[model samples]
Target: MRCARSLVRIQSLRALTAAAGGTVQPAATRKAPHARSLIAHEPCGQALRSLHTACVLLKNRPVATDYQEKSEREGEAAKSLVTYDDLFERAALEAKTKATFNQVLDVFIKRDIRRRGHVEFIYAALRKMPEFGVERDLEVYNKLLDVFPKEIFVPRNYIQRMFNHYPRQQECGVQVLEQMENYGIMPNVQTKVLLVQIFGEKSHPVRKYQRLLYWFPRFKHANPFPVPHQLPQDPVDLARFSLSRIANDLDARVTVYQLPYTDVCETGEEVTQPYVVGIQSPDQRHLLAKHNPSRPVFVEGPFPLWLRKTCVYYYVLRADPLPPEEKVEEPVDPERCFYYPLQLELDLERDLGDDDSFDVDEVDEGPVFAMCMAGRGDQATLAKWISGLQETNPILGRTATVFRLESGVRELQSAAEPEPEARPGEEEEELQSRGVKQ
Candidate 1:
């Protein structure tokens, strides 16, 4: 066997040397030991033969082919398992803000010239924009659109256009627009240009852009009372704005009972005072004055009033439903206003005439005498509000008062039954409302 192996090695070396046009000595003239030594000395020939043998063995072996295929499959599966959120997390290491979000996009853009996995990246960006605080930003959205390779997604022919060319990418682009629409962000000219650049003039995203352009302007000012983007930072100012918004009366006046202040006592402990803001119209004051002193009035809250993203607690000074026997109907003056008639005697088919009243029965919940927003919702803080109301209405001083507050955030408690107390031994923001006679 050793002699055969040596002969084979010597034959390979001779064949290589002959192929190279160099003079080769016959393997028959050399001893097996000399042939082995010569084969070891020629590195190139030995390496070539070893490589050829390896290739032949690998071709014939099933295990190596299966292993190579399995490894390739595993690599693909692992790549597929990696989610888009990981990309955002990996990119925005410091903080998830607009700057970080843009940095991530820029990295993805410059990472590959082709912008591979862009559809997935855009979807990830849409999901993350709210966290990054850039969902409503037009420029960020434009930058996101700019990720798609220009003119590639555009259908070349009418056949491609008719058959939803690049369906996945088009859907992705539409998804981006849908998210923008959900946020009530009106797409701008630059947004249109980006859409046109990414998807052709006759694409779903471009159509969406057109629809948004046409309809956004029409409904932009549709909301009569639009909340400002930035709410007031000062609690008092926020309370004032919130109170006035719910008041709905132009004649309603807002009063600040206390300004937020911090004071250091002689003991060197700091005491923080919460603000108190109250609103009442003349009609509300009149109603309060007419309220029966024997019947109890309720100071009910911390009911939540949401202004944009910020939530505020407001208390209402209200009474229970007035009994039917006690309810009085006030007569309207005929000549109160010439421009607008008080009532219509002729009741024909109600068209678009002066009769704007709905035929439904009026809901009489109760008269809200006054509403107030306070920094702290404790009984002590609210008692000050009732005292302030007395200066105007004077009926509060004589009237029986009850507190109907709740421990939960944004919960409304019925002033009718004031028996349920907040469960004891639990630390929460509010203490339960108990019926205590004033």
Candidate 2:
């Protein structure tokens, strides 16, 4: 009976191997039946099972290899797909104007009904807005907000709302609003409507819009001295504007010494003259008139004055601080004030709480006689300005003028100087070459 059971197990093992497409010889075909029975005993069961598993794997090998190849090809194809930035670059190839920018956005909308990869597209658009000169434009921002699909990201349930559904898309929307805020652009009614349609009423982007509306009005005119957006393009006009801004006094008068012009002489050389504009008030003129002829007045600067993004330079005529002995105080005329004394000598003590003055150092610098802006900072150009000043205040000629000009100022090319002669070594080399030829 044991022999029969062993034979039955051997038969079952042979059947499994054959089904797995592996060869198994029958006992009648074997040279020694005794040896075969010993090999197919119960201990051989695990070995037979392992052989069958190997046969099964061999049969499926081709399919596995094919599946791996197919997966690699799919990965390469995914990598080859064009990114959102490529779309903007392609549009910019023609022109990077506002019209081209709008056309690119329009093409993106028409290309896909579902607007795939829109978050990436919006980000790319935001970065490119400044290049196309539409960073401050409200319409472009509204159009960008329109790219997001409506009602998809809006939360359907309280759980979805609590967890901040579609966090990436919401963040993208907020970034668009942030860029608008940076450019000082206020969103319109259409922007609010678009945000509501895309991200629901309680989203982060909506809150940002509410905050902008609440605070934009309060700070719109916050700058006490607001500069004009479009500055004067004419150099003379610009000089006038800058000089008046620095003068501070309403009684100041602007004098244009020279207007910018280009002259072509009979010798066929082009000569360009820079503009000179100066400002002086009644007080400044009066101070200049009292200036002593013994002491010298200094022409100092190309001090920098910034108006918005533009930088301009101006020069000032000032004097050295007088010595303590030379300083004279003007006495007040008591006849002008009949009700009370014009000069008061008081000795009053005050509490520390009553002191309202700022505790800062007082610099006793010399008084500024006048201020001027010119296209050129060279001495010759400034000399013409001084000549012009002598007309209004003749005292400027009597007071010895000293130039304290700094090299920081931009000076225009005054008739280009002749190039220095060749170096001594090069001249000697030329003489040697001529002697060798002889």
lDDT for position 196 in model 2: 97
In model 2, state the lDDT of residue 377.
87
TM-scores, one per candidate: 0.74, 0.71
TM-score of 1: 0.74
Model 2: what TM-score? Answer: 0.71
- Candidate 1 lDDT over 1-438, as tens digits, reads 544565587567656645754232233223334554555565443332223333433444676777899999888656733656777887567887888888888988998899878887788788889888898898999999999999899999999999999999999999999999888998888988888888899999999889988998899899988898878888888888898899988999999988889999999999998888999999998888888899998888778777777878789989999899988899888899889989878957856766766698878898899999887888888888888888888778788888887774544566897685666663243433364555
Residue 117 lDDT (model 1)? 80
Report lDDT (Cα) of residue 21, candidate 1: 41
